[model samples]
Target: MSKFWSETVKRCVPYVPGEQLNDANIVKLNTNENPYPPSPKVVEAIKVEAERKLNLYPSPTVDQLRTDIAEYYGLSKDNIFVGNGSDEVLAFSFLAFFEAGKPIRFPAVSYSFYPVYCKLFNISYEEVKLNRDFTLPVEAFFQTDGGVIFPNPNAPTSIYLEIDAIKEIVENNPDQVVIIDEAYIDFASESAVSLINTYNNLLVIQTMSKSRSLAGLRIGFALGNSDLIEGLTRIKDSFNSYTLDRLAIAGAEAAIKDTNYYKSTTREIIHTREWITAEMKKRGFHILPSQANFIFVSHYNKQAEELYAALKDRNVLIRHFNKPGIDNYLRVTIGTNKNMELFLNKLDEILA
Candidate 1:
């Protein structure tokens, strides 16, 4: 507790992202980053923008990019909100909608970021427990003191709750906002984006980092009713009117518009996730039912930390959370075929 530390800093419990080891030889499956590169269009768009507009500031409203994203999702620009990344969008959402006195609700085992955001914003919250099987208990999220926010697939567990269940939560919380963090939805079966037009309180947040393979570009967006979008926009403009720079805006625009590239990459990741799930099961790991570009699993006999440590020693890294209830599990990102083959081979060696 330094004297210089503000109350916010003192209360904040920061989120620990996946380890980013710089070893070229490592097979990284800890972070759920796409195993592919951004589309050629994304590359070309970024280059063109860089040459033409390095001297000019990016559009604060981000109109063209928002319009492009809306067209892709069959919504209007007014229904969209773009930020530096989904993390920023989420931060703005907490400040814009959730109040400090009214505690919001989210799954206990959900995105690690939710609690951190709650702490940073000084917003009170309740951690709704997930089912024993790691699925979200929709009934428990109903009629919250504040609003509701949770990942669609409920991170680390990677168990997707259907939209019908999501609708019930939204309908029940009619007076408050219900934010769905769909960072992994592109890899999943469906998105709750369809519910935005139907529910004024629904906000579906997504990122171009994963499926779009632009993790370096730092782009994320939110889809919601125009009012919710406006609220987020007000918060964003208050903080940084130009949250996304010119390069990021151009790259994100191309990423959103190139539907064909996203489809092919997304399909490949899904295929890889399925194959890896089956293989892990055969190896005696209890794999969770994942609809994302990653799989959550636990070896029947191996400790998660021990496996994690052993893999890191061999330059094959995956994620292991130390928090209870999920301390035994590991989250493995679906890499390219060759990368997965290497990961499996390394696992075999470690098991042997």
Candidate 2:
């Protein structure tokens, strides 16, 4: 502990992201990143941007990229706000909306980062436990609070809450802010972007990290009412005027516009998820119904930690959380068919 550290800094427990190994041959399925390469269009866009604008600072507002995303989502420029990543957008949300006087509520087993954000921003929050089936309990959100934030296809569980359930919560709590982190929405059954027009209190945050295959570029955005967007913009302006550089803005715009490529890649991941889940079930693993590109599975007979370690030793890396209620589960990202085959082969040997 450093003596120069502030009280808040001293108490802070930072978010631990999934492992990124230097070993290229590892069959990485820990982080929920796209297994496919970004669209060729994205590569072209980045090259064009880098060649033309090495000396100039990126557009302070990143207007063109925001407009492209807005048009793609059928929202106006005023309804959208862009940031370095969804984590930054979410941090701004916590600062701009969630407050200490009232308690923000989210699923007990949702994104691990939510609690970290709360601590970072000093936002008082409460954890509402998920039901036995690992689904969000919409009725639990009825209590009074500062705001609410939860992933649609909640992390580590890969369970999704239908848009109707979200609307039910929004319609009931018109006074509080409801931020739905839709980082995994592209792989999910549906999106809540359609509900933004009707509910001013609802803000949907998404990232290019997962389905868009632009995690390295670090671009994310939020869609909401103009006022909510304005609040995020204010927070963003105070922090970093040029959060997105020229290459990132250009690449994200190209990715968003390449609807065909995006859809094709996500569809492939979903298909692989289905096959893997079924196969794992046949091998005695209880796989949760996943709407995201990852599957959360637990075997009745095998230990999750043992499986994770065994896979890692074989140059395959999958994620296992050793926390309460989910200690036995492994969250495995859906990779390409070949990667999945390799993983399954390793599993066969390990289980045998």
Candidate 3:
């Protein structure tokens, strides 16, 4: 309520990120972070880069890292754009593509950050409701006034929409930009990145924080038609030239190049997710069919808030959204097998 606050600053309702407790003993499953450490190659690359270039500014164009990501995704460096994280990339997209009066469209229960970004940018938006089963209504996103954006396997729900469905949405909205945030696509069945070569209006943004076990390293990128890449580049250049540091560029390049380690760790997380789903269902939780590394679920009898508090008391943390219609559901990241076992044991004690 101070005169120092601008109208924009006063209007801002910032996104509340998952709790980052400092307790080393806490089993954190709230944020969908990889339980494993970043690949040894990523660490080595960072160490090498850190020793050589802490004083010099990073590449504003981020040429080599963009090249590495493009090579991995079978695209050209011109088709890629890198930023601090997908959140920043998304923020730039909202400014670059979506307009103030012309409202954009996203799922009513999709990633919470989408609405926050819309508010911050003063872009009007419509939240098209998902189907009762939590699947995206592809037609609802068609012919949007401004543009469209949503996570593929939507956040908190963890239900994946197929690429064919995605293609349909893109095809339907020929004039509008369709941004697909694929932060969890590595753990999923497939990626919409395959469709970008054919659809000029599609932009697929991804992060290294989840599947690559580099949450501590703030790196995210986008792949699309070279034009969209240029648009994001314009927005980025207008603000800051170097969104990625030297160490981040090197580590991200290494993470992109280390495909084998990424595959093994992603496979393990999928396996853990499968077993955890079964275990939770056996204990009366209604689980979504998750292709991502986390599970969205609700207990048959227990309240989500109560369960969340009980788990926190046991030193195990999971996410519980306080929003309407999903206040009873919790989103749990799939951890190591031993971690899941310990979580299950803690839950049994609470439920018993």
Candidate 4:
């Protein structure tokens, strides 16, 4: 709207994240954040780093954290690229690999941020519609004009694609880069990272925000061949050299080292998800077989909009997208057992 604004700025349509309410009493589950606190080791390491270096800048290369993450995934530091968050890494990938004239392919109902990024960067993209069951159509992504990127255990729908199908897509798109956003992979069955060594074009991106309980820390990384990592690094260096602070670096390192704690929390979330799915089905909700930490459902007798408003009024928040084809569905994060119980109680009251 401003006269001084450039064409790029004017054309941008920013992504809208979930509402963040600070009320302690509300059972918050709109965003897919970990319900448990981070590991004690992570907190302690962050505290130690905070006291040691308040004046100095964090390592520009972020070598140590990258090494730790690489070790965790059985990859070398050269194959990894750390960023402020997975969103930042994805942005870098968009600039590094995708071209403005060539078109990229992604799921139509996958991460909402893909379209936002494409629009921002002037990148032409093809939105391949998902199958009737909300599962990705593997064949549709083969031989893309530019490249491809999509969340593994896709967002909003919470449906996970098998690794075999992912391999097929990567094999077919041997010429172009295939970026797999694995933000929710910890809660899912398998990771596409296993295919990175076999396929040079595959880039697997992950985040500490979901399963590692570091949403506030904002740590995310990408795993790919050294060449693709170098490309991401070039984009990052052009944008901002010091994307991560000392606290985030230290916290992420500790989080990667403390695998047992995070795994325990992940198991709990999966258990809670199973229980919640059964409970919702008992209430006449048809839910997808979710492999992530959230569930997508639509009630047989209730409207999604009405349910969202009713839950909000009861201080139990969940997500309801007003977009076509999925307007009737709601995406609810799997919170703690207590939080889920409260949500179900509120739902029961509404149903009554």
- Model 1 root-mean-square deviation: 0.8
Q: How many pairs of residues in model 3 come into backbone collision?
A: 0
What digit string (tens of lDDT, one per residue) describes model 3 on residues 1-352? 8999988888878999999999999999999999999999999999998899689898899999999999988999999999998889989999989988999999999889998998888989999988989899888888888889999789989999998899989998899999999999988888999998899999999999999999899998999999999999999999999899999999999999999999999999999999999999999999999999999999989999999999999999999999988999999999999999999999999889
Show pairs that collide, candidate 2.
Answer: none
CA lDDT of each candidate?
A: 0.92, 0.91, 0.93, 0.94
TM-score of every prediction relative to native: 0.99, 0.99, 0.99, 0.99
* Model 1 per-residue lDDT tens digits across residues 1-352: 8999999999999989999988898898999989899999999998998898778888999999999999999999999999988999999999999988899999889889988988898899999888888888889999998999999777978888899999999999989999999999998888999988899999999999999998889999999999999999889878987899999998998889899999999999999889988888999999989988889999999999999999999898899989989999999999999999999998999898
Candidate rank order under lDDT? 4, 3, 1, 2
Q: How good is model 2 by TM-score?
A: 0.99
Model 4: CA > 4 A from native: none
Predictions: Cα RMSD each: 0.8, 0.8, 0.7, 0.6
Per residue, candidate 2 scores C-alpha lDDT tens digits across 231-260 of 999988999888988888889989999999
**Per-candidate clashes, comma-separated:** 0, 0, 0, 0
What is the per-residue lDDT of model 4 for residues 1-352, given as tens digits with 9 covering 90 to 100? 9999999999999999999999998889899999999999999999999899779988999999999999999999999999998999999999999988889999989899999999999999999999999999999999998999999899889999999999999999989999999999999999998888899999999999999999999998999999999999999999999999999999999999999999999999999999999998999999999999999999998999999999999999999988988999999999999999999999999998
lDDT of 3: 0.93
TM-score for candidate 3, residues paired by index? 0.99
Model 3 stretches astray by more than 4 angstroms: none
